[model samples]
Target: MTPGTPGNHGPGPGDSSTMTTVESPRARVLPWLSTLARLVLGGVWIAAGVAKITDLDASVRAVRAYALLPEAVVQIVGPGLPPAEILLGALLVLGVGVRVGAVISTVLMAAFVVGIASAWIRGLSIDCGCFGSGGALAPGAEPTYGRELARDGGLLVLALFLVRWPAGRWALDAVLTRKDPT
Candidate 1:
């Protein structure tokens, strides 16, 4: 068929309709990248949550070390953070509500970045307690705010990407949304 003809497909290898709607390589690749991002972010969340869930006291102490919130808020936030992380992470990993998970991850990372920056500015020596067992650092132990910030920042970027493009190969979101595999 002639290119651009009413019943003809837009173009063929030798045709010149110039109106084809072919997907770019990047579009094809993004889903895989998103899948990787989802798994990594999810795994990190699960690990961090599991680490702290076993030691609520230590989590509380870590929150207290920030010295930013009221005691009452601290009590709730410290114990609550781990489970929230776990839930968000599980959602991301399972590709269920991936966008929602990414949004939550972004917020948590932002909070972490703020907390680490605040601690560094105040010259407080304390472990982030991100993976668990965080509190005041021992004598001569230095706070690793730079490293923590860098890690969280990277995670934030990943989360942002997922937020932008939550469609991944194995995500439940894709299936649930009934996206056609064009």
Candidate 2:
């Protein structure tokens, strides 16, 4: 209450005592977040691909149940996609060609979101093929499209962040940078 003294604008709950209000450029946080996001999303994709690869038929059926694709397209896309997911996930997590992988992930997730929403809107009971056969129970039953949409929406946000910032920190790109003797 002392007019001569500075106001007490102390840290709030969940804040550490050591935390200081330092001004940082927006440019700095984005790449770090992008790297973290890439790894996190990549892990999910890896798990999904691995699970599906274990049960190809189940995955194929799940994709088919979506009723979003032609049978011929499903036959071709279903089997091959799992491996591609695995590869992309691995590349992303490993920080190899991470920007490219993030771009691919963003595109794929966007496509899935569209497909799942279309099925749900049309009142088709189908599997989302999200986490392979573990996405939703009962093939002929209407899956929890809202939940799946939310999850994919979250992932899409991360993907967009990656697309903007890229996995630049602690990555091969950083390692390859020329040393600057400032």
Candidate 3:
């Protein structure tokens, strides 16, 4: 077929515009949904970190319950994670330094997966302690490290996506970087 001519099979280049039709309503809505997800998840991480900072002792206890860390390590990691999380979350939410933040978040999620897996292997029931306090493992319940891994893995993927595709619609990054004809 000619360049502008309609193909007998696939879409022709001339007929194809930059904006192609999505097959599903969901496919069309996914971008907006992704933006919202980033915002919400980022906010949640920030809030959880702040809350844990306000109550380090509780956070430490929650971390210890995972039975994955040495007590000495817990003393350091438990206290440090909140501040790190706060920084990462803020960067992600603001769309500033998002690549770095996503990397950090991915690391944290990986750590969480390790902790959960170790606890499960050792037959220890414990909370993942993902979102600050109030999370606890129920007795006789096998640890769901696999689930936590999947959940956080998905979140990490989302973070990476957000880093690549910024929340440009309504974000501080866009505001600060707006081009002005000077």
Candidate 4:
């Protein structure tokens, strides 16, 4: 059989021209994993945002406690964060613009992680204000930077996964983009 002949045993491995690419099991499984990651991350953002939206002043105070930004910046960021979180979360939950949502989520989580770590390093005892109610901690109250960081880290991983594999079942992006799941 000739090397390039159809049905011929190729001289150097199978002929690439006639070969069909098969999806790996991992590849097949990724969409579901992405869906789970998207929903979980979205829910978290929604919960956090809802917790803070009720009291903008508390959110402001939480940002103020960090002392990482100028007062003007703090004023804007503190009130602005909750709505942003809610919007991002809703987008993820609805599977709309999932990659963009995940990217935004990753950025937000990274910022929180940095803020918490900085506060810990500076020995500033404060609530993370992640789910609202943030400010200086009471005297004798210990900071839970480790737990907060770990939680945010986990969420960041989820966000990264969603960013990489945004094509999930029931995703509006998939429908709008006309992506065939199979």
Candidate whose lDDT is highest: 1
TM-score of 1: 0.84
Tens digits of lDDT, candidate 3, 86-137: 8777777665654556666767766776776777688766667776653465
- Greater TM-score among 2 and 3 belongs to 2
Q: Which parts of model 1 are misplaced by more than 4 Å?
A: 1-21, 138-140, 179-182
**What TM-scores do the predictions have?**
0.84, 0.77, 0.65, 0.83
Instruction: Write the number of the candidate with greater TM-score, choosing between 1 and 3.
Output: 1
Task: Name every residue pair that clashes in candidate 3.
Answer: none
Deviation from native of the Cα of residue 105 in model 3, angstroms: 1.3
Estimate, for each residue in 127-171, the C-alpha lDDT of model 1 and write its tens digit.
888888667675677778899899999999999998887766666
Mark the regions of model 3 whose C-alpha exceeds 4 Å error after superposition.
1-34, 134-147, 179-182
Compared with the true structure, what per-residue lDDT tens digits does model 2 show for residues 3-28? Answer: 11233233222221124355354434
- What is the C-alpha local distance difference test score of candidate 2? 0.71
For candidate 2, the clash count comes to 0
Query: lDDT of all the models against the reference?
Result: 0.81, 0.71, 0.63, 0.80
Number of the candidate with higher lDDT, 2 or 3:
2
The Cα RMSD in angstroms, rounded to one decimal, for candidate 2 relative to the true structure is: 10.5
lDDT of 4 by residue, 32-91 (tens): 687799889999999999999999999999999998999999999999999999999899
